[model samples]
Target: MPEHLRALIVIVILATAVFSLAGKTATQLIPARDFKRRRNLWFALTLLAFLTHSFWLYAAAATFCLLLTRRQEHTPLALFFLLLFVMPPATVQIPGFGLINYLIKLDHPRLLALVILLPAFFTLRRQPGVIRFGRLWPDRLLLAYLLLVALLYLRETTLTDSLRQSLYLLIDVLLPYYVASRGLRQLQDFRDALLAFTLAAMVLALIGLFEYARHWLLYRALLGALDIEWGLMGYLGRGGSLRAVATAGQAIVLGYILAVAIGFYLFLQGVTTSRLQRWLGGLLLAAGLFVPLSRGPWIGAAIMLATFIASGRHALKRLFLLTMAGLLSLPLLMIIPGGQKLLDLLPFIGSVEKENITYRERLIDNSLIVIERNPWLGSVDYRKTPEMQSMIQGQGIVDVVNTYLGVALEVGLVGLMLFTAFFVTILQGIRQALRRLPRHQNEARNLGRALLATLCGVLVIIFTVSSISIIPVVYWSVAGIAVAYVQWVRLQTQPHATLDR
Candidate 1:
């Protein structure tokens, strides 16, 4: 058989298993009766295009999303999250027509957002508004941050290039946020959208586990068939073991996605009644989290859990129990075969790649020196600095692993402040919303807590890696959910407002 055919076969088999395992449970978690109908056909069609290396895959996915939206079969938000990680980020650049000589690049998620969520954004603007976009402080901060970056980019590039970058920001960043914040108006919308994210992450998790076991980058062949040069598509390893990248393009990115998924699973497991199902789901997620072997996400997962616990009732007692569990598990983990090696791979205490931690420290120190040269508005040639030159790896590239430091280097302290304040505002809103909710409305409160914890995890995780791949999009959409949750809580407190819908 041909290589493409073999790749397609593997994709189909794994996709089937993912659907079979996650479909029924997803349906049960979904409170909306309309969404309970069969989802198999859509996944089948999407898989054909995604794995078969079809040039027309973008059009097919976009058209199907539009059709679903036209028929009210799936909300734009649900479709976006469901298909977010289904396709690898192998982009194809379409040649420009007429006055535009530059190329326009897009991947599956960007096309879906443009086709489905972009229109939904305009429609949302037309609706009689309960809460307007700029009404929230985070909204303003986000816009300001974008504007600042756009200006900085324009200063360093041609008009045409600046416009292209701006368009990317619109489609990739704003569209996801707008659709998520506005489209999810009810409780079921929240459940459906989040469940869609969890299911998609579940699919990636399963694929990651398989790749780890097989020592193969499964989607790497799909890229070869499509003739796309995605930089992160190649294999990565740690401690002589394959770190599964799956569709995320990088192992760290995949681990970040799984960490966020586990955070969502915490909220999702609350809705299901079957103890066995919940345990199975948790085990699957935990196993998935392990395969990537990204220590950053491991730390982030711990922070997420701690935040989730701290935000809930009886925080101290629950935290103590969690600590006791960890303390007790260490001894048991040490006794297992290869457990000592696994423990050594952990962050801060890890012996494997301890140099990476040193590199990050030097990166921060050197990056600070670069920032100090022009602290207000960063230099466009920051990459050419002698300080950065000294830190170049064997690959001959200065890897800015820290997202926060990257922002500071590119756009300066003002841009960094705007970006930081954006999430900080969202976190504040979620906390306030949780406070206003009644104790009887446990589910809503839990969802708020989950988003809060997830956002916190994202903020911390990105510090260990740059805002690359799906990392930024995941954080952006999660922040949108936090804003939506805040609005929903406000709606519930209002007179004659119904939240169950």
Candidate 2:
């Protein structure tokens, strides 16, 4: 068999095993009526991608997926998450004519969003009673951020190039946020959408574990099967262990997705029927997280747990016990065989990848110096600066690992403030909504807490890694979900309010 064919077989087997083991449990959280339809659609799309020989055919498959889900309640959002989480970021640029020589790169998420999400979002907005996008502060802030960055793009590139880049932002960033914020309105919508994401992540988790065990990237040949020349697929290692990238293109991205899934599972476990099943699901996600060996996400997961604990009842005692348990594990780990090697993989305390830490520190220092040069609108050629140029790695690429610094360097302090405020506003809304919930409304309150913790954790971890692959997609979608939750909470608290669209 061809290499790509073998790789596909491995992925199919791993995904089948994962679904067989935990799929029913994950799908149980969503409505039974919707599950069969979505599952069929998901499999059909996957089959099309698997059998198709060209990128355009895969794009058509994605477009069909979106259109079929258009009229269904929250299925469009579900399909979007399913494709976004399950597929890798394989790209093939559509060649443009004349003055616009370079068109948009239609990656998996971008193809789904551009081909359908934008049109669908506009169609939904035209309806009588649907929730509007910019009515909320987070929505307004996100618009401001996107517009600011788009306008700033004109400083460096041609009008055509800038417009193309702006469109990329619209499809890649805004559509995900818009569909999520507006598509999901009811409690069940939230459950369905989140469950779709979690199930996809569970598949990714299983794939990551398989990759770690085999010391092979099972999905690398996927690009070849599709005949795309994407550069994100490669091998990475830490302390003699191959980091698992799965379909996430990068290990850190995979770890980040698993971390977010684990956070969602925190809320999911509460709604699940079987106690042992949910625990098993959580363990699977945790094990997936470990395979990536991405310390930043590991720290972020810790922060998420702490925040989740603090948000609920018995906050003080649970946190204390959790902290004590962590402290106690240090000595226990030290005495265990090969514990020292494991300890070295941790952040701050870890000796392995110490240079990465130093590089990040220098990135912060250098980025600030470069930002100081053009504090208002930022220099478009910031990457060409001596400070940034010096930080270039052996790969001949200046990897802007820090998302915040990347924002600051690209669009200056103003854009950074807008970007920062967008999340901060969303976080504030989540917190405010959570406070409005009555004590008996534990389920609603818990969902809000999970969103709060997850967003907070994502915010911190992005400081360590750049906004690449599914990282931005995950956070943008979560923020939109947060906005929807806030709206849902307000509707619940109001007199004679109905959540029906």
Instruction: Name the candidate that leads on lDDT.
Output: 2
**Span of 10 residues, lowest total lDDT, candidate 1:** 32-41
Off by over 4 Å in 1: 31-38, 50-52, 57-69, 97-100, 496-501
Candidate 2: give its CA RMSD in angstroms: 2.0
State every prediction's TM-score relative to the real structure: 0.95, 0.96
Kindly list the per-residue Cα lDDT of model 1 for residues 126-164, writing each as its tens digit. Answer: 766535777678889999999999988878988998989
How good is model 1 by TM-score?
Answer: 0.95
How does residue 62 of candidate 2 score in lDDT? 66
- Number of clashing residue pairs in every model? 0, 0
